[model samples]
Target chain A: MEQAQADKNNSAIRPVLFCECLEKDGIVRRVAAALLGGYAFTWGFTALGTTCLVALGMGYAEAEVAMLLLAFLIFLIVFLWAFAAVRIDRVWKVLGGGAVLMTVMAWVMQHLLLH
Target chain B: MFNGFRIAMTWVHTWFGLVLGFVLMVCFFFGALSVFDREIDRWAIPETRFEPQPMPSFDRLLLPVLEQQLSPDEQEYAANMPKLHDAGKGPMTPRLELPVDEYWAYTTHRDPVLAAGGGFRVPHPKDPTLENHIHGRVTIDPRSGTVLRDDALKIGSDWFYPLHYKLQWEWKDLGYWIVGLAAFSMLAALVTGVIIHRKIFREFFTFRPWKQTQRSALDLHNMTGVVALPFHFFFSFTGLVIFASFFYFPLSHTLLKPLHDQHAVLEAQRAGLPYERAGVAVPMASVDAMVREAKRRWAARDMAGEVGFLTVTHVGDANSFVSIYRAGSDRVSLVGEGIHFKASTGEVQYEDPPRAAVSEINEFLTGLHLQHFEHWLLRWLYVLGGLLGAVCIATGFVFFVEKRKRQHAKMGGQGSRVVDALAVTTVTGMVIAAVGMLVANRLLPIDLPGKGDWEKWVFWAVWALTMAHAFWRSAPVAQGRLNPAWCEQCWALGVLAIAAVLLNWVTTGDHLIKTVFTDTYWAVAGVDLSLLGCALIAFWVGRKLMRPTTYEKNAVNRALALHE
Candidate 1:
């Protein structure tokens, strides 16, 4: 009887402990997302966007200022997206994958298309 | 606690905004003033009042002045000109002309009437004053071909514009980076604020000034932040974009070095500026003819305004070119089109053309930001938006402190006290400093060495002193009372405002009545009236602050009654 009562008590407290940990984790993830999303993501996207614009027959001089301004808008959107996201892991995965794909495309454009 | 997006945004908005509100408030206040910057310039430097001259024909009227300047006798006269303050004694102290770097043939948009009448001006390289600047600017009554003023000087666009944008700190542009950072944070705060404002449309229109302090503060904040939300958002983002090149152009150089080089080549070719000075002496072709031709071309294209700026490159060389651009008021783009003329041959080298689409858009945005175009209603709207932004940010500071003061008092009162001091210094102190600078401008000897520089120093020093005063008086607020700093600063602002007005009258002999009657300089008169308005408002607020609040009166009554 005593052993059973102890197990029941432990089970009741388990969910509460789990909830506290999750709350702490949410805070950390949001902070990380803000820093990474606002700065690093912004830079990568601007680089990719400006490069792609140049490749698409837009002269660099014409595209440069617009691209820079668009970059600010992108950073704002990405920052909002980071916090609104339900899953932190998914946010990083999409951003990381997008960053890689952009890098590859930029490389191809610089090496093959421009040349 | 993490229940919704709005809650999260609330947290973000409060903390981020509170952190940078002080700097943002200062920027917004000064920026709002900079909208009528020329009016303030006319008010501060009274010598420019009622000074209007029509455009001079460069060859017939202004060129002779330049030729005479190149003369040996004129050169001797220029060389022996008295330095500022060195020749000074009293109010009649002679004003000294600044050393000229280059003679610029520019046009006046100081007053719309002058601008409309085709006011072309030769701002002598030595004249260093502000708008309609009488000094060193050789204005030939365009019709008469006669010299106007030999000692015309102005501290042109020197103080207010620079203070707002650069904090007047030009060394490595450190102030720019700081302002830029605050602008970025403002963007973040604005975005988060929009998110947190659940009933944004309703809340935007909802301002209950009659409610209790906390509710009223928040309502006022929402109304201002939401009402001018678009202006705040666009200005902050564009402000950064305009200067982001300082932070990101290096990245551009690294990533697309060849494109930049190619662009440079194309730019030079387009402007017809690539020709090096042919290593032979040649008498320069008539600049007046070039100006006339350029004007003709601009007029034919229906893009004529005034001689915005004329730059002569390779002055006496065969490859010399003179580039003359039109005034920007005729278009939305700050960057106006210019014709490039071959200086040696007087032949049209390059006709000004429309910019590429992207450049046009960028120029338009900057022009919108600058508002050099003549539109009184739009200009007033811009000023109103700026003031609204300032009120919103300042209220945010006050609300933050009001909400947390009791809690902080319970817990030792350090946090609330610091914020209160900062809030007091930034908002009230800034106003006091602004009025004080105008007073300093009026009081200082007109020919004081580096008058503009002295005015800038007075501004900073007064502002710094206010900060110290805030700290000293804010200590009592830790006991949960009102900080006397705010009231004191308001009273100071009143005195300073009135003093500035009186000094302007005493020094320039342009009192309110005379200014309005003479009416030649509505710009100056309007500025003086505005200062008077500010003084009246300050006095009213100061008197109101003198009366103790219900909380304070009760605290005292409760103390006496408990013992009784």
Candidate 2:
């Protein structure tokens, strides 16, 4: 009788409910990933921009312009990532991860070129 | 025991914040802006937007002008100036030697004019028509005594710093003391808040935006305060220390028994440090040549600029010397040990102690306070820190109100009235004072009898009126049924006043557009834009509060059902 009741209950609920649940989970996952990506992008761009400017140090205006362009591009990517993260549910972890990754990237870039 | 103590401290924090929270908020906000006071001035005044002029070499024209202005007695007094052998004794004597040609030859003239201490100065022509009193450039050849660019007074950042700090009032040291007290209260409130918030860390990550009314306010209060806790602490502590000598340092009489210091010895040391001469002339070296010599001596150290002041001691005696310090370091301390020289022979006398021990400590403290480091990155960080401190104070005020509101709602009338009054001042009263000040700045008649003093009076008068209005309107505001329950009237007034300031500027023909595009595109435009931004924010807040809450809508439905 209990099993029969369970079957009835399952029948009463729409199959779309389960689908909706799955969709929500997928959205959250994507949002988390996007946030991480955005944070990494921002951190990497900031560090690179700082190091590049310092390294150039008025040696050539053209080099500064090029570095600035690259920095702006990174900033654009970071902004998109941040916007996505804010919109997505359960995505802060992604943002944190992204920041960490970007910091690592910046360190690598600084060592390779600036040093 | 601990729980009881926490509860008692919470009460203390609540009352303290309620009493001074709104004023503290304004102080912090203004103080933060003041950190960039110079930059603000640069942004505000349109006419003075240029890279700073290199310091004019003093000797080229001034000395020759001195030669012309001062009598032979003055010349003799200047020429025979004594070595500043002792720190306290005065200038030596003056003498004059005229050269027949470029040859190293001299004829001693014992003219009475040379004996009597009189020096020469080219009378700079004045332009009374200019608004800022900075007209007619004085161009001096750095190597010679010729005037270069003397123009109208560069009023740009000069007025801004004073306005922010003391509103250009110089009397009684009252403004400084008041600001100091406000800073102290702010520090007290910050400390009390930390003590009261038991689950600060746990709540740091919790921000439920969907919460209704009181719950939502609490959440916001916690979020902003917790996120910016470190920032709040740094600003409060550092702000207090910024004026530490003024507030806490012992008096000069008490510390330096000779000066009868009450506060501190250092305070006493500043008394009449710069003194004037007795007008007795002695033989003196050429100022222009001495400057060159000073520069050459410090060329290895790359002293960035000219000495700020040149003092002549014992005018006619052979013991006279000239001290040249780095310019613009006056904000740190007057006595900067850089390059000192014997004016007669151009010999190096004194250089500052190496950046070690006492000197390093002084430099570090002053540098941190003045933000003298060369990097813009550090300045941005400082600005961010100040903003966080403001956020902390603002949220704390809101939290205090929100906590009391629930219990106050249970009271019949008196309790609610008190809370309402506090709320009005904490929120709208501050906005009123700020907008009022700006309005006064523009509207106060510039030609009023004693215009400078009147301008200062207008600010205080407006601030006092704001407090009075808040007190009078408190009861009606409390009884008002608008959701979020704040009287949006004061905020509306603020918005109107801000618009008026812009209008006044336009009417006066100094509108931001003309001043920025046609004249100078410097930072003064930034100040106007910032004021406009504030107006927009105030309007937004007012509109938001006027909207009916979900709870209010539900209550209305219940009333309709009962009527039916």
Candidate 3:
């Protein structure tokens, strides 16, 4: 009976993911995607969001602060989504590609405002 | 990812929580101590044990101190003068000859001394708009206007407080980035923790200490984590929020520098405050009278308060302005309601209006985390919340080890052993270091040169020793048995805590009896009592660890059989 119970516990504790996702390299990539990619996305979001809000006539300080207040929450969401998402490539594309797009938009907007 | 959302979150919660839990332990522990940092300062520096004082007379007392021929901090002058001064434009100004550009004095309700400083301007600056100033600071006895030794380490404020936020690792702001990452991970862990915890409500009241080690540790972890969930979440959230602009993102300084500069000029214009000094040097004003007018105006607005911060911008120039800010001891916000005046004529330049909604929310969040308020009950509650955070992280470490040690032992793996060692180092070893520093402070001669540096060395050395001892004894952990280091270190912590109290009495001659009953200095008395209470708890835990249950014995026998 004890042996049978131990076997049941072992089966219950089996890895949920296939072998590749459980590999060391796979874990590292996922973590990097979560932390670094999430950071890039959040930075771009803060820059663009602050610029857009300022362009919309909010006070500069207020707009910057409002965007900063939301930046971490957004980062937290994407960080978790990186791990939970179905495809690692999709996670990277969304975070990395979105980061670039928003950053360019913010730079262009800033250039217009300055000119 | 092959798992559902819950399992993925569980993986995140377990792994990220484990990795960052060590840093979070330091943050929570030191942060709890920082709630009564001023009180601890009083205990550490016995000479400054007098009652807290209000702001002293600025015109009569502070003016002479500020105007007296003062030299800029040597380190600051050496490090910054070359960068700030364009030597090609002119020779670098002598440290003593640097003209004063700003004067400021700050005091809190809990401060027995007033801290005053002056910013000395660099003549030929590389970037004129930048803060091109070297600073000199002094701590003044409010009652006597005497300067105290600047070398005395404010162990509470200087050491423990910074240790929480930056781990005292200031090399290229590595500590801040590491802490930021840990704080961000903390938020993720908290969210993932909630998703993973299936019986949060049931676990809030459940603490089965008599269960197996894994079960018991999880119970405590769940209980502490759930009970202080709001505190854990808000503190981590607000801590990040507090540094979000300066350290985390810094968008205004980087991406939005142009807009930020524009806003600054517009802000200065709208507020009628000068952003630059006029070349004309003239200082003929009574600052005391201006302070009185500021106080009267505050009273008129139905918020009577004492001055918490006073600053003179563009010092000794026509554009100079004196700004007085009321100490927010009565509320949860930081110092506010600043009133500015023309320094030459004492005419009111501007009075700060109420904050906007966003700024107000920001202030409240930062204020709650920084805790400048004077409510004793709320301070104690915050301490309780901080300790709960520490407990949650510590138990998380224990749960990690307890659940895996046996399996790792069966596999002849050393992962559990290494983690158990580090767990012992951070938990018990960290406390030993802090208490050991207090003991060293009491034991060192009061007049010894660089005594504070010696005390700090003792802290690091003791912590290193404890780590070594923990790792050496962590061998037993590979057998799925208790690390005897945990019990030994608990006793060491207990003994050290008691020694600190006794040494304080011997060195300072302020025994608990005298401090509590006769002298009535609750600051020192409270610290002494807390040390004794800590000793009692540590001894209790030591005693508990000395006794092994059936589970440990079974694991030990299994390990012996495997060796055969």
User: Mind sharing the TM-score for model 2?
Assistant: 0.58
Q: Residues B1-564, candidate 3, lDDT per residue (tens digit)?
A: 535788788888877788888899999999999998888888889899999999999998998888983558999999989888998898889999899999999989899988899899999999987989899998888898888787777888888999999998989999998888888888998899888877778878898886778878889898888889889989999999988889999888898898888887888898998878899989659999999999999999999999999999999998999999998898887747999999999999999988788888888888988989788889889999999999999998898888778777888979889989999999999999999999989888888898889988999999999999999999989988889999999999999999999998988899999999998998899889989999999999999899886666776797799799
Report the Cα lDDT for residue B133, model 2: 12
Instruction: Summarize candidate 1's per-residue lDDT along A1-110 as a digit string, tens digits.
Output: 75798478545422112234347666666757765645666666666666777778777766777778787777777766666666777778777666667655655665
Q: Which has the better DockQ: candidate 1, or candidate 2?
A: 1
Off by over 4 Å in 1: A1-37, A82-114, B1-4, B52-108, B111-156, B248-251, B270-272, B548-564
The lDDT for every candidate, in the order shown, is 0.69, 0.46, 0.88
Q: How well is candidate 1 docked (DockQ)?
A: 0.19
- The numbered model that scores best in lDDT is 3
Displacement of the residue B473 alpha carbon in candidate 2, Å: 2.1
lDDT of 1 by residue, B79-111 (tens): 433332222333322223322222456555663
Provide TM-scores for the models.
0.80, 0.58, 0.96
**Model 2 CA lDDT for position B113:** 9
- Give the lDDT of residue B298 in candidate 3: 94
TM-score of chain A of 1: 0.68
Number of the predicted model whose TM-score against the real structure is largest: 3
Error of 1 at B380 (Å): 2.1
Candidate 3 — what's its lDDT?
A: 0.88
